[model samples]
Target chain A: MSLSALVLHKNDNVATAVRPLESGDSIDVEVADCAVKIVLLQSIPFGHKFALQDIGWGERIIKYGETIGQATASIKKGEHVHIHNVEGLRGRGDRP
Target chain B: MNFMGYRRRNGSVGTRNHVLVFPTVICASSVADMISRAVPGTVSVTHPHGCGHLGEEKEHIIKTMVGFCSHPNVAGVLLVGLGCELITPELIAGEIAKTGQRFEILSIQAEGGTNATVEKGKTLAAGLLEEAAAAGREPVDISELIIGTNCGGSDTLSGLTANPAVGVAADILVTEGGTVLLTETPEMIGAEDALGRRAADEGIEKRIREITSATEVLAKRVGVDMRGSEPSPGNIEGGLTTLEEKSLGAVLKGGTSTVRQVVGYAEKPTEKGLIIMDGPAHDAVSNTGMIAAGAQVIVFTTGRGTPLGAPIAPVIKVSSNSGIYRRMKENIDINAGDILEGKDSIKTIGERIFREIIEVASGKATRAEVLGHNEFAIHSLGLSV
Candidate 1:
């Protein structure tokens, strides 16, 4: 699927919506090899990120090559990512 | 490059010869407001904090009240008090006296009551208006100008464009011996080390560390992380992720000028160059702190755009993205988006902004001023009663 929504990076594992998209709508997203069909698992609003790869709890989520937050639960490929799946890492000292 | 302005005895040039009426205590705010309203070109600044504070907070309130009256923008002052408030009208009167300007005081108890106080205040205000109007404009050097820098609703383009452009303008102003006040202490959280490296002296570096660390520790005590609360929903949408990332862009509004001094909230900058004010990241209170600090003009960068303005000082709006600039042309005065579009360099835009600053200083109305968005608020240091 050729996805025109978000491209996290050339080597990253998530995409953000440039605009809002509904769940189950397939968008053509450019990834590795050819255009990949990304089916929205949940409605993604504009500017919100989505998982490009599987993420685990307590692991850092990198956006713009910086740590934005940590994954709270396991997130699969193309899953809608937001506050529910990511938790604020307070008093965690510093990011590595 | 010069517009007519009111020249003060202190060698400061004022854009407006406003008669300021300040209520030291909340109880006297109504009287001050009534007095200000009764006289044209008079302003009333009222806040709810002068009564229930102690030590440093009490001192902060008094200093702020003093600073506002001596702001250089005001031609004269009228201090109203409830007589029994912690900040006495006498003390407030003393502060105004130090400025060597015309001022009068009225206490509710001394004047018999609120009605009497208001009448007394109205008479005083009317007299002040005529006196201030007599103060004529004289030619003053650019060095006499104290400008404040702020960025709000930041986006990816903020750091890359608007902020750097502002930095250039600030650099020009600073090099020319003008003063620039850079504030929003919380926004400096993640960039302390970088800021420290730019500090002019060890004492300034230490002050920067102390203020940033103090805010961080306070946030931790409140069970909230400063980093998490930053990059608000709007900021995230604009491509900012971490607090550190947002701060890097935010601090660019300060330019590469040496950290001349660090001031507490509402404290005026005594020295010229780039001074940091310890204030909340909120625009309303922070802008008020800068205005109170004697900023005659303010250069505000907005990635998402804001219409906030000060009652006395003129606020110039700069936008990072050309898209937003095109969409909100009325709210934005200058567009730094040319940097993003590769149409111009930072220096080019900086010159344009510098010209606008002079133009506004010469009496050009900013978008906010044109829209009458003179919302003002002073940052509170202690608990409200």
Candidate 2:
């Protein structure tokens, strides 16, 4: 299967969409020496990230092998991970 | 590796030999511009500051002006002044004289009027240009190269593609004993710890924290949140969700190198390797500061795209995605988007970028230079009044 997205690091929990993905599309991705297949749960815009595995609410969204943010809500495999369900941990006056 | 560069008297190598018409005060900017226009091959450095600044703010402008004039790329300088501003042409000339470069000062008041000053400035600039033209590029080592890295109009691809790819190229440059500058302090908020870990020593790590925190404190004191402005509208639209995410990607351009030192805005680094400049994230302002600090070339990565270039330095623009590269083909120098398409590997593209840097350093005109995009801005720390 052709690679549809890029997994930047082995520890990254999310992958960026190289091309837009629509609901019901089955995608194959090559991550560090391994291949994974997942069915899109919703349409994911190009350049946006999607969950490679189920992420519970408030869990960190890992990319570049680092935590970029935390999921505001539970994110399932292939679900779009963006501002809608993620919260930045930096510079927020509310966060300690 | 060696590239043809103008060897300065002070032992510094310049990628381009240009006679700069530098204005010491905002009041004399028009005459400076006029002189630069009348003399071909001469460039003018004009800004709104140079008067009415207080304390550190005033000193920063002075230092940046001096640095720009003394830059190796400037073969000579024609200093223009209003004669009454805090930063006098004489003072600027004194600073540049330290570098043993040719410089001549013309104050509007001293010359009796704008018309007279313009005439004198034109003749001086032409003479300076003739002297500058006499200089020729000699073989210089890669270690003399100081490369500035910056990103603007960024998107998700910025971190994944262009930024990291530039990072790889930066690593190669550092390995070759060259210097690389990573700026945009506010952009390092979320990734401060990660960057701190890469510092060469505790002092640099502390300075890095100090500068990044200062930016945050200033914004907070002004009753604004840094996050509110970061991960800007363009970033959000391009799939970046938070400031941390944006920052994590933003720092990739520096590569995995030790932070040798953290310098104040427009401050030159004393040590080689990777240095971080303390300045705002504004594209043009940061680029200007780096150029003033003595970066002969800049590698600007963008996802949304910008056409910013420095007057004294060549800014090589790299587009993160193929779409923006195709749309802004005339402006962007290289496309790292192929990495995203699985057509090119990051290391290969990184080598290509490094080679492009060598080419630009050897007098290859970048898109911005060819388009005459002389975007210059100085970061102000205090109110003009």
Fnat by candidate, in order: 0.04, 0.43
Native contacts present in candidate 1, fraction: 0.04
Q: Where does candidate 2 stray beyond 4 Å?
A: A1-3, A33-35, A54-59, A71-75, A83-85, A91-96, B227-237
Q: Write the per-residue lDDT of candidate 2 for residues B1-385, one digit (tens) a residue.
A: 8888999999998999999998898899999999999998999867897788888888898889888889999999999999889889998888889889789999999899999999999999999988998899989999999999999987777888898889989999999999999999988988887789899999989988899889889989988677677676666777777777778889989988999999988999999999999999999999989988889999999988888889899999999888999999999999999887678877788889999999999999999999988888999888667
- Candidate 1: stretches off by over 4 Å: A1-96, B1-5, B112-114, B227-237, B322-329, B338-343, B383-385
TM-score (all chains, Cα) for each model: 0.77, 0.94
lDDT tens readout by residue for model 1, B122-157: 888888888887877666778788888988876656
Lowest summed lDDT over 10 consecutive residues: which window, candidate 1 chain B?
B236-245
When candidate 1 is compared with the true two-chain complex, its DockQ is 0.08
What is each candidate's DockQ, to 2 decimals?
A: 0.08, 0.44
Docking quality category of candidate 2 according to DockQ thresholds? acceptable
lDDT for B350 (candidate 1): 91
Give DockQ: model 2. Answer: 0.44
- Tell me the lDDT of model 1 at B27: 91
Error of 2 at B310 (Å): 0.9
Q: What's the iRMSD of model 1?
A: 7.7
